[model samples]
Target: MNTTHTSRHRGNDTGTGATTDRTNPPMTRRLSRLVPALCGLLLVLVGVTACGRTESSGATTTDATTTGSELSYEAVGACKDVFSRTDAPGAQIIVLWDSTASVADMPFPAALAEDLKTASLDDGTLSVIAVDGEAVAPRILAKDVALSTTGERDRPSVAKLAEVIPACVQSVYLNGLVPTAPGTDLHRAMTVAAEIAEPGATVWTVSDMMSTSGQLALSKAVLAEPADQAAETAAADAPVDLHRNVWKVSGMANAATPLLSASREWVRDFTRGLCRGWNASGCKSIELDPVNPVRTATGLPKDPVPPFPAVDAVTTATTCSFTLPDELLFDGGSAELRGDVDEVLNQPLALLDANAETTLRIVGHAASSGAYTAAELLALSKARVQAVRDRIVAAGIEKARVSSRGVGDTEPLAEDIDPSTGLQIPEIAAAERRVELIIEGAPCSR
Candidate 1:
């Protein structure tokens, strides 16, 4: 009931805006004023402007206008531009899983969705499709309106933009019930996605890369061209990158066991390879590396680094306890989560689900340091704790099972020091804003 949420505020180096204190009322009020201004300014600077007129060309356009509804025309336009430049026009992501696999066993869809949501684009469109069966024809399980520059960031919009794994549908198909009458045809599925794409679009096939009877068929279809018309077709679509954005997702088999010991390395390698391939293949991939200081030295416009989300460390009993590296936390007095938090929390959540009977309790703590009274610190700490709790629950945990407690300035995980300067050691105050979770009971009966 009583929880302490301690957060620190740090200055933004690029001068976009001051970081808001997570718990301070005045700071919140101040941010309310500044946020609109900042957002407005950002909108103006990056606002979408018509580059060229898109007349109705003979190219078959899949009326993806419906899918763009989730993203603003401006954002969609930007994404389109990025993807187009990367030779990935009208992109599609496919998540394939074994027919016999359980919902919990398949995480590629969720991971793919998260990755797609965060993908940056200057002006192009992206869509995700999932398939599981021998049906030469792959039906669109879910299609979001094509996004552009100007659009609202609503739930439907976000969901449309995000690539959700079709666990529910997959479950149905795996039960010997084929969504398509011909059964799951991976080759045909890829072909359909490629055909529907704007001429010269990127097609990312995310599956276990395991094929049975359909493997050769799919490969031949992907590589095939009409002999007489192949030259003409290639000439017309010459600008389109021939290299398809086919990313195979494997290692679901590894998650079948409890420990996920074999899957861990596979996941890391697969994710890293996927990211690197997407980038190299010119697919407008999200940059995961730390922003290089040297880019600024070259007098290039500094890429706007988005603030990362804050993630609490979860201590699982069976696997190794994973805490986000300190570098992922907000610098001195900041409550904002860093981008690295995504990497830190994503894997843990998958691991937690893999191990049945693992229950988690989230505890929020606030470090009482600098400029605030004890009462103020307590209130702030509680707010911070609640923030973490909310995020966890949103990530699919049952709220009723997970409890939050605020311990104000009680236990210090590290020596109290100024996160920015590292010089001003303030006893043990820096550890206050931490949110800790303890795995308790058994993993919710899935």
Candidate 2:
């Protein structure tokens, strides 16, 4: 780190026959003042430069000023002791980072960087590698370097480690932000880590476990396979030699297409097989994390469209019902479906599609406001139900699988009369006016 220096010159006249006044300070006093200033400067240099060098470990320290980013103080405080107190401090550690767009919301890189602070060993090595579409050289952040057991060497050693580890992590994170890598190559990355690992070493892989373009490329078909079968397929794609080293998979995020529970189980089983296969002792640790919501669209209303209430489906063991308000599906006194009803109807359509044997029933109800005669109300309700049924059939459900009915103003979802005065409640009456999709044989939970 560079420190700016400021100097001021005070001149004493050096003319011929000119003599110094008695008020002038003596040489010793001036030297004493200069000594403290020099000591202060030395302290600043030590703090910025990792005290120049370590005598015991011979570890090289990089200048922190050269790095573009540094780890936050809170992160350091929270993770300083994570790896330091482990039983085996002499184990070599290799970290494989997923440097792709998938890391937009991931925190594994920063977390690993912090934990590495206390995890270093005086005789062990620490390496960080970026996993991307193509292979790249691993960055050896620390070599045979550990925090000092004695107080004299501890501070500088920590300072040196703080710089290099975070610098490497920052590089990985920045790469993910503006990803040039086309796809994820998790299998190759793990292979590299395994090759460099010793018998007792630990290889850490931080990824979403979704390989889009590689020998181990993933698809819906792969995810649909049974756990063990999927594992066998992954192993055949890229065989790895773990050398009996431990493999730890962390932050396996969800893919957008598959459901969360399915994706989580598939990844967990797949990784377990990869670690247990290829001469590895066992899968040491694995963590499955939900992909951050920010990385995916929420389907929330934007500025141009006015915000409305969200639609939801109610389900039982053998039935699912989605209630669409009459106003949302059909305008006042009209049986024709509205143009904007597709988005609202998709919620129920998804539930029906999930179960192939499910059957759909569209039932329509009308409010009894005395605006039409009983015959007219029944006709209107039947017409509305038919319109809704047509849309469901058009969405690909077989005509035989769908049925329609209308109750007119006979079946009310809420009380239409006020018991005290026998007067009608407008809000309650409105609540009864809706079209309900009753799905039979649909899965209760999805």
Candidate 3:
């Protein structure tokens, strides 16, 4: 796709190199011829030099050995160079900053600063676009900033960009850090990246990559779909064709509250698919920088709750059962309900309210493993379901409408014991331990 730049702030640094179009061929030829005489005069004056004028050729060949003695190697410079390739004229680096509420609590990535410090943008532009909402535009952070000043005439034999580029990045990044916005439209952010990106530009999407709102909103229901299907469905909202650009997603699976393993995996897969939808030259994700001690995720929503884990549902014309795995509601060996159980019970409670004739039956199961004696296991199971029944009754449901019971290690989905060693399989045991909420006389709507 053709790259369209909307930013009037983008500065084209002509000093870096020549343009592709040959506007004045005759003048160029005359200058080309005069170059030999000038080189010869310079050689005579210096008394020792190559005729090709290698030192003044403008291109400084990178040498690992010379980095320490001739030039100080730094991490920031390396990160900058990853985006600002000296040979790619008109290249720009777009930082798709995600200031959505989901990541508001997270501190800015510390490694980003170190990585940027070692970069030498030379003549590249660094731009920042807030992934604030679906419509935010790109802004110039360091327009046409020269990142390195090494070599003769350039004289960088001792120079480093350990300060300049990082300072620019920090200045722009900090200035833009205002109160957090609500949504994370990653597809929209990527489209903006493409719109503002120059050919060969590298786009860095720095956020949790959770599209929580808008057309590309990655709700738990959407994330529940098969990875490829979910990705394709989201991509269909706004597809970007990045002909030669690169897209890297960082700060994924990171939040004030740790995300579920399934959540992380689904987001990774969805983003991978989204990147493919954009047709980027290269795609990188979940590549977060080291935590910045000063910028921890303190802005998280108060008592933040992750989306409820998926539970198995059984439905009929008049009865519905939800199987919530034990880990979701209790600590191992404990019957007390988890702090989040109230939220988890919202659905069942609502269903009961809607159908006044419905009666709730809570049944708890225990793993058959040797974690407890059969009597203890049975007691624990009974207490667990009783806790759930208490919660439902507390939520304004009639106490008489709810009945609870425990079935200890009687119905296992998998073999709890290994025939060879007779040891319980941890996974099977865990899976076997679950509580089922059965609602009778009403059809569940999901």
Candidate 4:
């Protein structure tokens, strides 16, 4: 069996999408015959018997809580520790099962969703959105009420979610393996999830990510036109603001095979990097611990600072300086890059012109709030740098002069207290997502 999963934002201008596909020999060639039985058991265990009333009224409209204090380096580090533990706060996990024929018996999506629900979020909330392969749109599986001011769990919302999830699962089963589309519209589903989610929510999606259609859908969602025109038409429409965080779980061999083990590992790595000041581009920033006023007054040595690796790398002999804009580099406790990165890169590229001697080196960095393991950080850093490199090359930079590198969490730019925000800051991790231009030889006149 083969499965593909794709995720993206929809209904907003935040153009982001991810896709993955895996191929492997069937561990259960014989088990292929047992898919029906296994799938039946899965439905019995996780299916929904009822659909809750649509939450159309009195959904609490509370402002997302923002810690006024800058994310201190210490705080970032602490966040990393919390994210990596099994006891960490639970995250809202959304599973979109392809009802397509290729993955009719795959229990992997359900199993992974269950594991994520059970994963600890400490004081965090968990929600689920499950879609049937046969359905034209995704269906809500589960959700909890907004984390309340008093720290009490909203049992009503949780109960509602629990009730709906099984029904949604059953819906998938009843639909019975319609031919899986070449791709699922994961982007649309994710956009729906983002709109429904509270501000600052974390999202995890599990799927094989095999569909080209799904990928295209995600891309379209990310680049969708801003809703300003529609909002203006509504007299009472306040400007719509959108923000969402997404982590993708890929590398599963087939849609039917359970790969929760691998998916969990990826999620763990992704979250750690996110909370530790990894930027929206999936690059880490140099984070600094907040200067303790008392410690400074008492002349104590600051908290033991972790050694960061030097981020400078030689890419095709171009010694380029890599840096990130202070604002877009890192946001509090998240790895998704903020701002239009293509616009940001344009600034530096403009400086280079089309000089023949100018060689560009795009270096990606992953900062740590102390959450990401070395391997995870490295992957995030490399991907971000390469993304920028790809953009630069596409924008017309010479391929020969352009190269990319990932410097995993090894450099610092400022005190971790985000200069923009007064709170204790994460380490200066954003500087790592930088592009450098080396003027090799001299400018070549066109």
Q: What is the lDDT of residue 168 in candidate 1?
A: 17
Top-scoring candidate (lDDT): 3
Q: Can you write out model 2's per-residue Cα lDDT over 1-446, one digit (the tens) per residue?
A: 22222111111212332232312335224323322222223233345422444433444433222222433333232223222222223446777766455443455455565555445323234555666663433333322222212122143444444434444344433333322345666777667677667667767777667666566666544543445676787787678888887666666744433333434555677778776666576475565655554354233111110112234578887898888767567644699887767866887788777788989889889877655787788889999999989998899888998999998988887777678977656556656778888889974476
Q: Which lDDT value does model 1 have at 152?
A: 26
Q: Which stretches in model 2 have alpha-carbon errors above 4 Å?
A: 1-90, 109-111, 121-123, 134-181, 254-259, 281-284, 296-346, 349-446
lDDT scores of the candidates, listed in order: 0.36, 0.56, 0.58, 0.37
Q: What is the lDDT of residue 392 in candidate 1?
A: 64
Candidate closer to the true structure by lDDT (higher is better), 1 or 2: 2
Report the number of the highest-TM-score candidate. Answer: 3
Residue 353, model 2: lDDT of 75
Query: Tens-digit lDDT track for model 3 on 184-300?
Result: 556666676677677767777778776665577765456434556768876776678776577777777565456544455556777778778778756554343443222344453
TM-score for each of the candidates? 0.26, 0.45, 0.48, 0.26
Question: What count of clashes does model 1 give?
Answer: 63
**Cα lDDT of model 1 by residue, 354-439, tens digit:** 65455555555665455666677666556655765666677777676567666666666775657787542422332345556565
- What lDDT is obtained when candidate 4 is compared to the true structure? 0.37
